[model samples]
Target: MSTEKPRPTFQMDGHDVPFDEGQSILAAALAAGRYVPYLCYHPEFQPHGSCKVCTVKINGRTHASCTTPAHEGDVVESNVDELNDMRKGLVQFLFTEGNHFCPSCEASGNCTLQAVGYDLGMTSAHYSPLFPDRPLDASHPEVLLDFNRCILCELCVRASALVDKKSVFSLAGRGIQKHLVVNAESGKLADTELSVDDKAMSVCPVGVILRKRRGFQVPIGERKYDEHPIREVAVQKQKGE
Candidate 1:
């Protein structure tokens, strides 16, 4: 068999991006320093577009950057007031659907969902709270599952499926009653293949799926929020640069 590697493709914002065989639009954009807001999409895991916060204008239509493929001559617009407003509205819906009390959350200062809310100027919840009563799963020794704080973004689900290759998490029910469930028979995370090293816990944007023994390990002023805007971080990570 041949051992040759493939070359990378390049594209500009105004020009249609020439996506190589397997490159995603998000990857191409960030490789070129283009800022695209995203959650539920980590380079380490497969893209899950459940967040709907990464919507961008591509050739005049809104498309989720995580799943959209780059094409030659496609005019991609990442920053638009209307698109930002849509993202803020979507995040607002997420906030109302769960108990995202920032002050009491272990992820408060370092949460990607919260950071994205702040970046999108979602300071208040305009929708009514769903207030679904959810049980906290603390059976696992390394992670905690507080379903109340979950936005159903599916980051954990994707990470568990794609990265861990075990598919340990999933959403059950629908609409207001939709909730995250563990793969184990007891519905607890304790006996699953999941562990502290699993990206499922770390990739969650809210306080829902959390590390049991590692909250506040970095201190208030030392977390990623203290270093740079999440948009910059997202771009950097997606580009792998």
Candidate 2:
């Protein structure tokens, strides 16, 4: 058997946090019960750094928490109100760009995007809707894609690449016209290896990607997001780590 030394632990925001060698700043903070707001981040997937929502002030400068590795004596502060507002504004921009009709959505109560909106106190979307008449693909028989609800977070695309071990989803087109494209040639999700068990379905923050059978399985009141703020959940998850 091979022997290897374990990574050291450090203090962050008054809590002892362990960093396993290449563990990220965000991962370390989560282990220490510090609530850092983020989107486009999943523990089981690779860090893409596409979404700047998780940016934090590290040593008096902002850094993408997901991409920054945890080191000894690093000062990470996540409680700044300005940072909070920035995240809120990012969420607002995402909301205005998409057709996030909470009351009519199947993933309304349990969606992380919705929870973020509530945390930001965004009662209504102020910007004009893009109203892109994108196609809804229910060809997979187990998943549905409502492109109008997409936020281009790349979670679904990354999940298919990293977690599911299949590069099924990709971003087609460019700029304001970019969108989640399924497989090659055919736009149908069923044509690819994307299964119901894929992480892409679970990683989508908005109702853009949804499960065909699992929608509304849990009542609105019983959903994990309905009872607590996203910050509380992040803190609890951090503590559990």
Candidate 3:
């Protein structure tokens, strides 16, 4: 008799998905070759569940798949039209809330938000543009901060505090006023201990944190998302490709 136990499985969109112990629904699904549209959920960090883009129905009620634990025999619905429409709306809101003029943005092809927007078939913003007049932070000689392009995912904040061991970034205000701020008395990246090699510098899913004078080094069309859709790239990355 074998001593090893069988893996727990869940029904995702009618397909059987086997998950390892302590895996979130999002993590397990990606590992099982299932693609779920998400923005704030990164496999590298603990599940934030801030962005509800991965919202899926479990049994009857909805939950954020990124934070939801996988259980045996749980019926999860993710790839349905209803859920996809809701995800699309969330992406649209993100687009309109920020000045994501994709053509003019440096993170156009490489941006996870833009890739998720495409995966969800977001044809238009649908809502009127907020166009919040946010200031750009160019005080850092090695990095550039474009506040207008930020979706407030807080990847940088978590990365700085956890991985890099430096609390370089943080969130301020609440709700509509909630935004990213550097942990500096002068409120600037240059004043903080942030470096180009820090984990926080590369964790931004958008163009908010970028290296100065390093634009288009790989060329626009040759970027990561440019070669493969984020759906494929994200899952492949999780699979250690």
Poorest stretch of ten by lDDT in candidate 3: 1-10
Instruction: Show pairs that collide, candidate 1.
Output: 16-73, 16-74
Q: Select the stronger candidate by TM-score from 1 and 3.
A: 3
Those runs of model 1 whose alpha carbons end farther than 4 Å from true positions after fitting are 1-21, 239-241
The candidate maximizing lDDT is: 3
Residue range 137-222, candidate 1, lDDT tens digits:
99988778888888787878888887789899998998777888999888878879897777776778778878777777877767
Ranking by TM-score: 3, 2, 1
lDDT at 62, model 3: 97
lDDT of 3 by residue, 160-185 (tens): 99999999999999988888898999
- Highest TM-score scorer: 3
| TM-score winner, 2 or 3 | 3
Q: What is the C-alpha RMSD of each candidate to the true structure, in Å?
A: 3.6, 3.3, 1.6
The TM-score that candidate 1 achieves is 0.86
Candidate 3 at residue 3, lDDT? 50
- Stretches of candidate 2 above 4 Å error? 1-18, 238-241
Error of 2 at 111 (Å): 1.0
> Once model 3 is optimally superposed onto the true structure by TM-score, how far is the C-alpha of residue 220 displaced, in angstroms?
1.5
